[model samples]
Target: MYTVNQLGKMYNLSRSTLLYYDKIGLLKPSARSEANYRLYSKNDLKRMEKIATYREAGLSLESIADILNSDDTNSTTILEQRLHSLNSEISELRKQQQLVVELLGKDSLVRTAKIMNKEQWVNILRSSGMDEDDMHRWHREFERDLPEVHQDFLESLGCSPEEVSSIRKWSQ
Candidate 1:
């Protein structure tokens, strides 16, 4: 048997984290000591090991609990869903990296990448006879109609997260 602190130390998790897991019904102590302190058994340790592995795979505590309380088929489906999300995030990061490389004037591999900087985008808008008010109206319409697409367009233009946030806020 292991005390809560000992188990936490062995798993590299905080005592509060373990307690929270218990509170959330994700993990419960297998036994209690004479002092009424939480005591985990070998089976508990095995469960904790599975929790750690699932967490390392980026599964949420809720998802980990669901996976643990279910069969192998359910766990596989959850893992596959997480994999899809991770792949999409990786693709977005790659686009952002390419934009950053283009911004830095690194004329090696990313020079031919079709990325439009802020200045070029603004210039194109101005050339198209879109004054400041016209652009604002356009943004408003875009935000009202397709907020997610607007966000993606802003990100593709290499806007900083802060800039994108500000634009979204005002567009609302």
Candidate 2:
């Protein structure tokens, strides 16, 4: 048998956290000392480890409890869902990173357009086949004056200067 403090130390949990688990009936001490100290058994420790694993995988305490109690809950199904969500999050982050890399590569073009005070970004957007109405809506909502910023963003997509100029003229 392990005392509350010993169990807490082993699991890297606070004494209060273990007490809270006890109060919630998630974990019950196997025995109590004559002095009324909480004593956990080996089986309780193993259950705590399972709780920690589920918590690490983003399951809420309530959800973990449900899974533990339910006869129909399948561990494989839960794992597959968590894996899918993590993969989707990773894919989104990768796309954002690629966009940032493309923007950084057009640093020189960005600098030149900023100096010109011309809407080079509008040209860039037009070159990229981005809708004029969408650009107008974006400009109105964002109140951003730097067309060169958009130009740099578009140039990052590998558009030619001629194409960008044509789009800029068409937009006007």
Candidate 3:
């Protein structure tokens, strides 16, 4: 059996955190010492390990408790919901970032906060089944149909001014 302090140290958790787990009925000590201190058996260690894993996956304490207590829990549903929620948050954050860059009126700031580069753009196109010839044709069409937007798009990919100029010249 391990004392509360020993278990906390083993799991890199604070004493209060373990106590909170106990309070929430998520993990109870399997035994008590002679002096009434908490004593965790190996089974408790395994339960704590599962709790740690679920926490790492961004589960709330209540959700963790439900999952631990229910023998028929649908963990995949919970995980998928979390994934969708995270995607929405990321999209909102990207919009906020764009607004900040625009508000500052600093194109250089956009470069500093660059989310993608020319290499990444090229890789994405390649992954989407675009060959070199297909990419050139697409760029030519973009330059012909929406020159200004095309320029901004290239700049957004973190291209230098000189590189953007060369690409536009070739796209013609």
Candidate 4:
């Protein structure tokens, strides 16, 4: 058996977070002391381990609670949803990273990337009579020559992450 403090320290969780979990009916103590202090049994400790594991895997507290408490759980769906969300986030971050790399590549051997709004780029493209096909080829050629500048140029035009990714894909 363990007190809340003991269990929290063992699991690297704060007392308040554990308390919140309990309050939310996420992880109830298996027993109580005579003084009504929360007493977690061995089973509760194991449950906490699972909770921590899921959290580290990027599962939300609510989702963890559902997994722990719900009948169906639907763990496969939960995990798949989390996986897809992570992939989308990673894709966006990659676009931003490519932009930064190109910007730095052009300016200097610096390590940071900055951004501009999208409309500024569109106006410049309009002035240049840049169409989709031309823009597509531009990305390919720019990437072929300068390596990273293609994404940066697109970003300078104020393109969204998805737009940048789409342009890169089509250019390929």
lDDT of 2 by residue, 30-145 (tens): 99999999999899888889899998988768867777766655666666777778766754654465455456775535443322212555687788887968876664443345
What lDDT tens digits, residue by residue, belong to model 3 across residues 1-172?
9998999999999999999998989999999988999999999999999999989978899888877877554666677777777766755665566667667775555667757657878999999999999999999999999997788778766566799899999999
- Residue 35 in model 1: lDDT: 91
lDDT for model 4? 0.78
Candidate 4 lDDT over residue span 54-89, tens digit each: 999999998887777666548777888998898668
Candidate 2 achieves a global lDDT of 0.70
Off by over 4 Å in 3: 117-172
| TM-score preference between candidates 2 and 3, better one | 3
| lDDT (C-alpha, whole model) for all candidates | 0.88, 0.70, 0.84, 0.78
Q: In TM-score terms, which candidate is top?
A: 3
TM-score of each: 0.62, 0.53, 0.65, 0.62
User: Which residue runs does candidate 1 get wrong by more than 4 Å?
Assistant: 107-172
Model 1 gets an lDDT of 0.88
Which pairs, if any, clash in model 1? none
Model 4 weakest 10-residue run by lDDT = 109-118
Q: How close is candidate 1 to the true structure, as a TM-score?
A: 0.62
